[model samples]
Target chain A: MKRVNILLGGPKSEYPDELSKSIKGIPGPWVGADRGSLYLLEQGIIPDIAIGDFDSINKKEQRLLKDNIADFKKFPPEKDDTDSELCLLAAREKYNAQEYYVYGATGGRIDHFLVNLFLPFDPRFLDFYDKLYYKSATNTIRFCKPGRYKIYHENGMKYIAFVNLGPVTHLNIYDAKYKLKDFNAGHPVSWASNEFLNETIDFGFESGIVAIIQSKD
Target chain B: MKRVNILLGGPKSEYPDELSKSIKGIPGPWVGADRGSLYLLEQGIIPDIAIGDFDSINKKEQRLLKDNIADFKKFPPEKDDTDSELCLLAAREKYNAQEYYVYGATGGRIDHFLVNLFLPFDPRFLDFYDKLYYKSATNTIRFCKPGRYKIYHENGMKYIAFVNLGPVTHLNIYDAKYKLKDFNAGHPVSWASNEFLNETIDFGFESGIVAIIQSKD
Candidate 1:
């Protein structure tokens, strides 16, 4: 299975220290969205594809990105999709990766965060909902369709949350500190701050998408 | 109309400079949740009530809260509801305010943020959905039920977003940079980064709740 990592234009402080190590260890293409290209360049890593409107970067940074990155796609500032969405679409179409790790998508404007978080709900990206994973300094978020799944606890992640992004039915959770069975929700709800009972936990839902977020305090 | 502001344990950096001014200008009572009680005290504003598990603050700070606040409600750390929820519940039952402004509830753990954002969906808080407002440094978020509403532009807010928290029908947007007419959404979707055409814009939905977010870049 192919894996690709895309970075957006969120605050630098939100990036985990392990991001650089992961970039070096993972053998996959790196796509930079808007100012994220400048961020990657600052880290001494040239992105495989730099895509965005380039509004956030200065002239010198844009020149640097153009000089170093071979594939740079620039769009107009006034566009329908956000820079992050455009970059994700480009990565999806070009790489067709089975898995996508998104960085720099959180800890910024609430609207931007919401747009990124609900991207999978859009018709253009709905099919790949399960493939997208959002990573920040303190959290890792994943979306799941209606199905049974086992989740392994991460080393430092103390809390796990199951949030229904829409209407959901018959949700079941097992082997967790707080267990739920045959739950139904009419709208978005976050059952947050749950802990794992063991190394792994099991959960399933009958319908709707569930966002499973693992985070530290 | 009575208005009460609730502050949560989110990071202090997310608080706007105008927070203190608003806290002073508004005459309504203030409620602090967990470490937020300490934050309120740091601002030299004595909260009317402090409610939480008191896990995030030191013993000294807890003592300060106990000493200063008239109503102090402490719960065990391992409780069903979060500190923010507990505080809101207490405020709702006691004050029965018509409007609520939430601060220090953004820019922290993603799970906590999600939990706070989706609080209106909880059955306990569902009746007062329209009464809640979340404020951060760069954003003001409000929820609305099925009704027509006129939104006047805030002085510094540059963009407006309409987000369907659930399945929405017959959503209409008028006098905005990007207008929508009778649009229906099957799931949660963020129509973000839209601008206003004039001093006020109009929007309405036939069904479901919509979150209108006004933000600055």
Candidate 2:
């Protein structure tokens, strides 16, 4: 399986201390979106492909990137698709990768962060929801469909929450510190701040999509 | 009209440059949640009421707050309602405030931010959705029920976006740079990055809750 990771151009203020250790050596090629290319270079990991408008970075950095990076595709700044979306498209078309891990999509402007949450709604990216993920040092967000899923306990994030992406029915949560019986959520309710009591967490829903956000304070 | 502004203890990393000027003398009593009280004190503003667990602040600071502030409510750390919720309740019950402007709700843990987004879902808060707002330096988030509304343009935030809090039908947008006719959104899709062309934006939806976020980069 070909796996790809995407780096966005979000603010550097909220980068958790553990990000470097968590992504030090993963199993795939990296793609940079906008200022993420500069971030990737700073982290001593050169991306295989760089995509974005390059508006956030200055001309000096852009020159340096063009001179060093072998494959760089720049788009007009006013284009319809965000740089993050273009990066995913490049990853799929060029690398043929269906699985992706995303970084730098949070901790900046709320509008930008919120838009990233809805990227899976696009018709082109609909089928890849289960495989798409947004990760940071303290949090991991995954989109899920109606199905049974088991999540292993991890030391990094202490709390697991289910946020409704749409109206959900017969939602069941089990084996956690705070367990819930079959419940229905009509809106994008936050089933928040649940701790993992055992080694694994088992959860399922009869219908509707959800985004599971596992995080630590 | 009794208007109260609530400040939370969320991260200060993304505070916009124009926040100070924008909120200089807004007519309202200020309330703080947790460390937000200390933040307000630092800014030379004494909160009318401070509400939180007080775990995030040191003992000396807590003592100082007790010595200065007349009304302070401390809750057990393990409570059902978050500090933000307690502060809002106080604003309503004690101050009889139906309108509120919130700060320090964004740019923190995803779980915390996500919970702030769902505050209006509670039955007690249903009627206060339009009057309740979460305003950060870069973004202003407001919840609204199904109805026709007009949003005036503000200097601090140039872009307006609509996100579905629930399934919305017959949504329409007008007098904006990027206009939309009657449309339906089944999921929490982000209709983001729309610019305001005229002095106001007119929009309406037939059913369900929606959140409007106006922001600037």
Candidate 3:
């Protein structure tokens, strides 16, 4: 299993301990982007691949990263993709990994956070979204294609929101809080925050993609 | 200038400061959406219209809002539009305000924030996108249609990213940190955080709707 880990510029310290406890069992070759590099360093971990223009980190920290990390790829100051995204592209090359777990990815500025969430929608990564998993302090989110998914729960999140990630034409929630039958949640009204009724429930959608956000508070 | 002020939830204490600052020297009716009502109260200011399901605010706060505000309209929990959206709809009917300024909208949940940024794509507000302006602490963003625009800057930000908010055929940047000549920044490699070079700059495109984010680190 070629496992790949990508960390974006987020409030990693706030989510570090939580993620460490949860992701300890998952194996991977970690990659860092911008501030995400500094975050991993603070935790005494070195990234295998570091990609960015090096704006977020100071010169001394950049030197430390250069000396410690195995490979560092620097793009010009101007680029089409976000630094975090560039890291993902590099990640694809290195990891034949079956699963992808992203950290330091949630919270901080809303714009950056949203970009990462919608990134999976990119045609390049859309095919692999089902294998992707992301964990913030109080939420664990992932996208599921047309299939039956078994969600394993940790105690942090109280509610589970089944956002159509994109608009699903006919979405049916077999087991969840606020069940819907053949639902078409259009553009404006995305299922904002819905609760999960039971501990472990079965959910399978027939046609479209669904983003599952298991959140607390 | 038919100025309209729409207050939505953000930081509680900063709400008043932002509200007072955003509404200063503006002549128009004010509108609040969902918890936006409570946000105005946090600053000791109330809007003319209270729209949407007051679910974000507690029962006590809702009661206080109803007692103090005369035009309070509540929707069912299950509705087609998000709360902030309903306020804009109501504002169109009641105020007929052409230019809308959304206050205290950034620095929140990523999902809510993204929806707000793309609010222009909503069929209800699609035609009026040019009249919209979104402000964050370090950035003032505007979504524009294709052609060209001249931006005036009092101070320079470290970064300014212009993304094809919707898919664009061809985009050309005359002067920028990474100036481009008739480049195709299609869907996947969407323009992300990029820096600025001078105090004043010009930009134009061949086609498509674009989001101009004049931002910083």
Candidate 4:
């Protein structure tokens, strides 16, 4: 299975250190968005493709990106989609990977974080919902459709949360530290700060999208 | 009109310094959630009521909270509502304030942040939608219903974003740096990082809740 990793320009503190340390171990190509390209280069990893408006970086950084990256796509700063969204679009058009791991998509400005969090809920990006996994230093977020899911614990991630992006119905969670049954939520709700019982958690929902977030302090 | 301020247990860096300086100026009582009570005391402001599970604090901190705060309501760590939610509930029950200013809510664990951001959308707390104001050091977030409204720019907040909490239709933005008209969003979309042209902005929507967030870098 093909896997693609896309990095966006979020706070450096939120970036997972393991991703930088094991860049060669991860499968598929690396796509960088805006300043993320500079970050990849700083880590001595050359991105396969660099895409963004290039507004955040200085002229020196821009020159570095242009000289180093073979495939670079720059758009006007005034655009419809965010730089992160544009990277995802470029990844879809170019790589079309089955699994898309997103880094530097969380933290910093609340507005930016909100956009990244809800990008999957947008109709334009709904197809990428199940495929996308948003990973940060402290959290791993993924979207799920209506179905039963058996989730295994990620190393060092102790807290599990199920957030309803929209109205959801008949949500049931079993074999977890906290269990909910036949819960019908009318609006967006974050059932946050839950924990895994042993190594796995079983959960299912009848309708609407649920964002499963596994996080650690 | 009665106004209340709620402080949650988020990162100290995210808290606005102005809030600490102007604690005397803000009207009504103060409510602190869990470690937030300690934060309030550290800021030299005594909360009128403190409500939470108190799991995040140590024995010394708990003793300090009990000694400093007069009205303290503690619950078991394993409870239905989060500490932040519990504080809001207590505020509603005790004060029934028209306006609620929430601090120490953003910039933390994604799950915890998500829960705080979506708390206004819950059915139980929907009544506080228009009244709740989430304020961090760099951002101010407010919720609005489907209506034509004029938004005045907050001091030092340069960027304004309209985030659709759910499905929204006929959304229009006027007199802003970036403009949108009659946009139909089927799901959550954060039209983020838009700038302000003047002192005020004109915006309207036909349906669904919209979160207007103003932030500065």
Candidate 5:
């Protein structure tokens, strides 16, 4: 399946090289959203398609991008959907595959990040949740709905957490240092830092979407 | 009525002078959570009591804090609520605060920050939501459930966005450059930037916990 790539622009002090490298192997087109496009271009990683209203960039960058990219859609500053979000919507309709990968939507404004996390919970995004992979410099978060997943982690990562994106019941974790069986992992109390014992772990659940966050400090 | 000052340390990068000057003038005792204690200490602003399990701090910093502070609670590293959340809970039960202002909760970890934004939405916190404020360097986000708020911006900050924390509804943003009588501020369309015709702008809503992000830049 052709994978779709999206890079979001937030207050990431770091350059976009590392995140771009993660998607280097993807077998599909890449797109940048608003500030994300600027960050990538400044780092010498120009995306194929750039979306969103250029409210965050100066006039110079806007003119330069208009000349460089294959396609650029500049929306009015005041419009529906966040810039990255607009890209995701268009990707679903355009891509030949079901899977999608999103980057740079992790940090910055609390509300911004929260909404990024909440993206998979939306019905439109949920339909493709099983196929989405979001990565940051130190972490990768995925949405697994009502199924088991075999996950591996890099050594020396600081933490890993799993939270019920919906009303989850019977969340079981095994082959990890911390194990839990038939327990609730919901809004208030999430399963955090259940590390891998054998360098690989398996998890299964009966219902609801679970967001797994594995991190390094 | 006695006011209570709670410092929320989720992961904010900077704290401006205005927030410090205002909190320092809170006219009540101070409560610190996790990284918030370090921030206040760096600023030479001391807290009367500190709470939270201290999961975010390094061992050395944690030791220095244990050596210095007297009225601090150390819970198990694994807990249900966030450090800021536990601190707020303790602050409410112990101080019976008439009002509260939280700092250092806006910047870090999108999940933690998002949860903190809706902190006031918690019924436990909501009992006193009108008395709470969350301030960052650039913006101030506060909660007023299912009602209207007349937000005034300073220094020509020039952005007013309303997020639909609840279901889709008609949100009216009046007396602004891009005035909308009844617009469906879609869930994905949370952040809106608009110029002000007048210094003060008005926003009215019907339901859900709403956050007004009045930002600059």
Candidate 6:
């Protein structure tokens, strides 16, 4: 699978350690969005493509990034798409990336976080559901279409949550600490803070969009 | 209006300073949910009612909270309603509060944050759309029904965002840096990172639910 990791300019936690562990064996092209390029440089991972308005980084950092990266696309600060959106476009259109993982797309600023949250729901990105992810130090978020799904157990994360992006119907969960059967979330309600009891969790829903988050404190 | 503030056992930031400013003149009864009671005690504000399963708090904290507050309702760890949901019920059904402000309901866990985000979208809580809020140290989140609304400028918060909880049609924004006129968000997209340019913002939609957040970094 052609997995692409796109770094965004949002917030950071105990990132470097977590980043190393999260992408231990998954080797893919790294794309940076604005200040994310500087972060990649700090982590000693040179990006293949640096795309954004480049407003968040200082002049010195910008010069350093330009000197290091060859395929860099700069835009005006005032634009229709956000810096992250532009990076996603480059990842999808330019590289035709099959699988995408996004980092630094959440935390600190709720506006940016909300923008990332709604990205999966955008009509233009609908087909990328289940293929794209919003990853952070503490959480890994993925969008799901209505169908049966199985999740294998993973360490380092404790809680599993399902957030309905739209009205969800006939939802079911099994082999989890908090099990649900034929539950319908009328709106965008959350079945949050659930635990993994068995080696895997089996879940399915009839209709609507869902976001599953495997999170740790 | 009879406004009541409910604090949940979710997450917190440099809360005291921001909480003090957010509710400086908004004097009303305070309610606590589970560990939220301990947080209130730390702030030297004893709650009128403490409602929750009480599993998140230590035994010592529970004892101290019981001695500090006169009214407390404890439930089993496994229950139908979330601790925060029970607190909202007390605020709405028991106290008959006209307006509610929620704190300590977002920040740490995505599950809890998702629960808080979907509270206003619940069928039982739909009638209280404009009256309920999920407030935190950095952001103030409120839900709006389909109607024209005007928002006056507020200090501290520099950005305003609109996230569609459902498909929003005929959406409009005026007096802002990025104005939207007669546009429809086909899905639950975020109109994020907008600035207030005219000391106010006027927005409305023909249908669907909307969450407005006044936020800062």
Most DockQ-accurate candidate: 1
Q: Is candidate 3 or candidate 5 better by DockQ?
A: 5
lDDT (Cα, tens digit) per residue for candidate 3, span B65-162: 89878899989977756677777777777766678877656544434555566676567876677777665555556777778888656354455666
Q: Where does model 1 sit among the CAPRI classes?
A: medium
- lDDT for each residue of candidate 2 in A61-100, tens digit (9 for 90 to 100): 9887787678899898778887878887777777767678
**Which rank order by DockQ, best down to worst?**
1, 2, 4, 6, 5, 3
* Model 2 pairs whose backbones collide: none
* Global lDDT of each candidate: 0.87, 0.80, 0.67, 0.86, 0.68, 0.79
Ten contiguous residues with the weakest lDDT in model 3 chain B? B10-19
Lowest lDDT block of 10, candidate 2 chain B: B14-23
Better of 1 and 5 by TM-score: 1
Ranked by lDDT, the better of candidates 1 and 4 is 1
Q: Give per-residue CA lDDT, model 4, range B161-186, as digits (tens).
A: 99988778999998899999999865
The collision pairs in model 1 are none
Position B217, candidate 3: lDDT: 45
Candidate 1, B164-206: lDDT as tens digits = 8788999999879999999987788888989999889999999
Give me the runs in candidate 6 sitting further than 4 Å from their true place.
A14-17, A20-26, A183-186, B14-16, B20-26
Q: What tens digits encode model 5's per-residue C-alpha lDDT throughout B46-156?
A: 776777777778988777677666777888866657777787777778777777767776544434554665455356776766666676666666666777778777673
Which structure is stronger by DockQ: 4 or 5?
Answer: 4
- TM-scores of the candidates are 0.95, 0.91, 0.78, 0.92, 0.78, 0.90
State the lDDT of candidate 6 residue by residue for B82-102, as single tens digits.
887888887787677788988
Q: On DockQ, who's better, 1 or 4?
A: 1
Q: Candidate 6 has what TM-score?
A: 0.90
Total clashes for model 1: 0
Interface RMSD of each: 1.2, 1.5, 4.3, 1.6, 4.9, 1.9
